[model samples]
Target: MNAVIRTVRADEWEQVRELRLAALRDPVAHLAFLETVDAALACSDDFWRERAAGAAETGDGQVRQFVAEGPDGRWLGTVTALVERPSAEVRFGESAKVDQTHLVGVYVRPEARGGAVVEALFRAAVDWSWTVEGIRRVRLYVHEENARAAAFYRRFGFAPSGERVPVPGGVGAYEDEYELLPSASRDAVTG
Candidate 1:
């Protein structure tokens, strides 16, 4: 598979919205994503446009969205990373103890799995995170029941931190948080 992993441009909001909706429709979306396709589709164009702009190069440096584009320019996957300042209140949980990056909205088309598309996307996101000043780690959450995702995250050097977030409801609906400290080493490519 020939694909290029790059940051999205502000003008590509429509594509961003489309890819997100596509991701939501995937079978594993319920386990990996927090939003539904219907909810995403209902979002006004202005919302998507603003989101795209915020993640683009021209926007603030605190957040970034990366995509894997096929040789034909079709989007195969995407992931977003947001930089968390030490003093900033965490968006999803408690206050951040260290400057870090939160990895979220990870997805890849089923047809594109095992083609290094995800690895490329991670490389781009993690590399960008490392470039941010004061960043000490990069973290993400995965549904506990999604063993495939947990294994993939472990393969990428992330480990469970023992800190869990309730799935906004109860015990039966929670996801486990996993983190990768800046000191951890990552293989540039995995077979």
Candidate 2:
């Protein structure tokens, strides 16, 4: 697909905002994302500016955002990794209870699926996570009904951690936590 997977720059907040909005509009966004389109659209420019900077390549190393850029320069997909600590307050379902990272905001355009784009994006994300010292593993959460995402995650070597988060106000839907430990080798192995 001739895509470039790289960390986003702080000055590209506009592109970041646009790509996030595009992700929110995808058909499975309800199952894959926590924020609504309207809610994301209502966010001020300053919020996006901060968000972009926080995950930018030049920002602190605690959080990193990677994007798959198409040949024409538009983003095809995006993902972010945030460092976590056992002593820190739980940001998602539960405290990691160990030094680790959580993967979030995963998105890939429908047109870009069934190729190496998603795998490339994940390789970059997981590679960056392992570069951080003392990191035990990388984690992510998928809506139980989002079979496609869960399948991809499993193929990428993440397994269920058995910790679940109830979808707030939802009837029975839940988010299943999955994790991957950085291997001594096999960084590119996705099965």
Candidate 3:
């Protein structure tokens, strides 16, 4: 079945929480995410509320979460875009030297893996990222061990910027940064 992609609603914190928990339970939760489910579960409801609100459609455009909903109202996949500014304080890896979007929290249920869901979700995110003023490019970092994700990003027209950051406490593991210039077309992922 096809999935419908859209920005998350502010009041849907429960759904947000559930989706995150599910992602955390995936077999690849370790390689795909930086946080464990235990840490996520420990967060207060207020924390989740703020998290959902901060990325909701009606919130300030700093961060936005895109979710793919199945026909039965279940979330199948999600990806979030965080606005990074040249002078703003850095959140992860190196400081942002340009106005760009940071893609994170990428997740797709195992059952929904080999379909159009990921592309649809990313399309929503990239489209939104370009609409943000000063967004010269969109970028994301993939764990070096996650070849599937790295290949997908390459197919998405995101090429390595030759920058790598060590994975905190990962013992030789690193995150590879990839970027897509805004001037590229939506059909250019295969480039």
> Can you write out model 2's per-residue Cα lDDT over 15-86, one digit (the tens) per residue?
999999999999999998889999999999999999999999889888999999999998999999999988
* Model 1 agreement with the true structure over 1-191: per-residue lDDT tens digits: 59988899999999999899989999989888878898998899999999999998888998899999998899999999998876787787545788889999999998899768887888889889999898888989898889998988888878888888876545477788888876563543353
Tens-place lDDT digits, model 3, residues 1-191: 47789999999899999999999999988888888999999999999999999999888999999999999999999999999998999877887878999999999999999778888888889989999999988989898899999988877778898888988775788998889896664656521
Report lDDT (Cα) of residue 54, candidate 1: 97
* Candidate 3 segments exceeding 4 Å error: none
- So what's the TM-score on candidate 2? 0.95
TM-score for candidate 3, please give it.
0.96
* C-alpha TM-score for every candidate: 0.94, 0.95, 0.96
Error of 3 at 176 (Å): 0.4
lDDT to native, each model: 0.86, 0.89, 0.89
